[model samples]
Target: MWENKIDINQIVEIRAKTTAFFGVGAIKKMADVAKNLSSRGIKKVIVMTGKSSHIKTGAWAVTKQALEANAIEYLLYSEVTPNPTVEQVDEAAARAKSFGAQAVIAIGGGSPIDAAKSVAILISYPEKNASELYELKFAPDTAVPLVAINLTHGTGTEVDRFAVVSIPAKEYKPAIAYDCIYPLYAIDDPALMTKLPAEQTLYVSVDAINHVVEASTTIVTNPFAILLAKETIRLVAKYLPVAVKEPENLTARYYLLYASLIAGTSFDNGLLHFTHALEHPLSAVKPELAHGLGLSMLLPAVVKEIYPASGEVLAEIFEPILPGFKGTADEADKAFAGIRNWLDGIGVTSSLKDEGFDEYMVDRLVDLAFETPSLDGLLAIAPVKATREAVRNIYTNSL
Candidate 1:
């Protein structure tokens, strides 16, 4: 029933700026990675992660052992939380700077890895604070090497050069893309992702879906983006439910992880538009909101808005779940219904209202969508113009 099948037992190496080692038991290679870093004169490192997922999944043990075996000094910075803040990045960077960290080992999902990217920048240029770096006060041309140990199949931070951080006081959540922030090494072990909670498994895959959706629809989209977008949708539509139902199913986890990896590459090449631009404000206003959940809540509305402009591409990519969807601009409502049904099928039945938002917040979210730094650039790449009225309508419709 599957096409172009992947062998679950085969470990694969993917080389890019970040040389990724992927498969079950891939975390075991951390010792070799550490030795390589040591050979490059990286003597001291800072290990970044969220509160406990790494430890729970046992990835942390392998990493700690590897560092010790290589005689590398390390500091564990575990205070990273969802919607990582500028303050947290600054604090971690400062600590790493004082400790003389020569590299960073980020051991969790997007949040920790994203934070580590910024921390790496600060480590290289100790004179800059997180705000200066995030605000693009100066373009950083270099950073300490980052080794990403991915624990979730979302965000694709391990492979992409994007990192998002929030400033709650200002209601600003912005992304930074720079060549220097790419990881020097990455590990995507499905074995480590097996223990992820059901909600997170759903949310993360939804995030990957949004990644490819906007990626392929953007004005800068290319053939590579379209190809990866279709495959990402197919893999997630088939395997997300399996992974959510059987969290310990390594095969499901492996394919879902592959979906995210390719989705990352897709967006990195194609760029993104309204969905991400709009979703950042939602998560920025409510720091407790998971980034993927926020994206899920806004996806259908954003897709509905863009379907008219990119109907043919979207209909083709979403056909795995949408079935006989006709690629017609006049059938935009059908496309919207198809996407909403797929979301419902995956246990994402919540909306902005379900998530405690109401009409009063629409104007504020719309304002933030445009006012946030770097978001305007994302909005500019949309197939349709992201006017204030359009942004407001998207928010109200999500509610």
Candidate 2:
């Protein structure tokens, strides 16, 4: 797929920045990694964690022990909220700066880790707030070195260089990406995920599959993204049901973790199209809607709208995973139908109406989606240009 994009000797960067340490007992290595980063003058570390499961699972206790073992002083911020806001990041950065933090450790899921990355960036600009860092006028800055002890099997933020934050005042939730924001390393321990409830597994697995399919079908896809995406699709289809039905299955948890990481890397390279672009506002406006639920409600609609561009291609890819799927005259629609059926089979039944969206919210959602630059940006790069009518139709159809 990438052969035509480059010359024989030209170079292109393809993988994520963070090196993942996969499997059980990975957290034990956190102390060693922190000590190594400290050799470069890092002393005090800011650890981004939440007040919930990190305490119950003993992840933070281990982290505290690690830091103390390394003779490192640390500050703990447990206030990271889901769909982290710019205000939270700015607050965390201020606290980190006050502690004179030299490095950062994000323990738990994507929300805290995403906040930590932003905190890492804002640490250097004590004179500026985190909101300023996302603005075009502010020059891009490097982040303090960061590491991740990821607890969830979703939101591959652990291995990727993107941080998403909601700006309530602006009605925007945009993913902020730059070179310096990637984690220095990731500890991906499936054991940490064994206690996740079945519903949580389903929500996150839906999120993973969305990343894979959207990346593969997007207009700007590269060879690396395609390979990673194809494998991700297969992995999620095979393992997600197991994860949902048997949350404590170590093998299922391991494979699901791998799928999320692969999907994250693929999307990092290929980027997302209308699904993510449209899905963000559903949560930004509702606040209570989980991101994965929003994606479940919105992705099929976007997929149905865009299928004509690569329907048969998608049909072939999903054939093995989708039961009783066969190419038809309307193969694209069939492909989408197969996906919808698969979602139903796995117990996902989210929709705009079922999720509390009404006719009045349609215009509001569209406008909010447009507020995200990526929506219009994706239209520019999409195989089918999302006309004003098309964009409106995508939202309305989902309703």
Q: lDDT by residue for model 2 over 1-399, one digit each (tens)?
A: 442342322212224588877766666677777678768777799999877878876788888887787788999999887788889988889889989998889988888999999888888767877667654336556888898889888789898888887877777777677878888888887778888887778888888878877777788888787787777777788888888878877777877888898889988898877777778877788777888878877766676777777665456556556545443435556655667777888888777898899888888887876667445665566557766667678778777
Once superposed on the true structure, which residue ranges of model 1 sit more than 4 Å away at CA? 1-5
**How well is each residue in 1-399 modelled by candidate 1, as lDDT tens digits?**
563386776778986667889988899989899999999998999999999998999999999999999999999999999999999999999899889999999999999999999999999888888887777788898999999999999888899899999987899999999999889889999999988899999999999999999999999999999999999999999999999899999999999998999999999999999989998988988888888888998888888898889989988999898888777888777777777888898899889999889999898898899888899999999999989999988888889
lDDT value for model 2: 0.77
Q: Per model, how many backbone clashes are there? A: 0, 0
lDDT of each: 0.91, 0.77
Global fold similarity of model 1 (TM-score): 0.98
User: In candidate 2, which residue pairs get closer than 3 Å at backbone N, Cα or C atoms, i.e. clash?
Assistant: none
Pick by TM-score: which candidate is best? 1
Worst 10 residues of 2 by lDDT: 6-15
Q: Which residue pairs in candidate 1 collide?
A: none
Ten-residue region with minimum lDDT total, candidate 1:
1-10
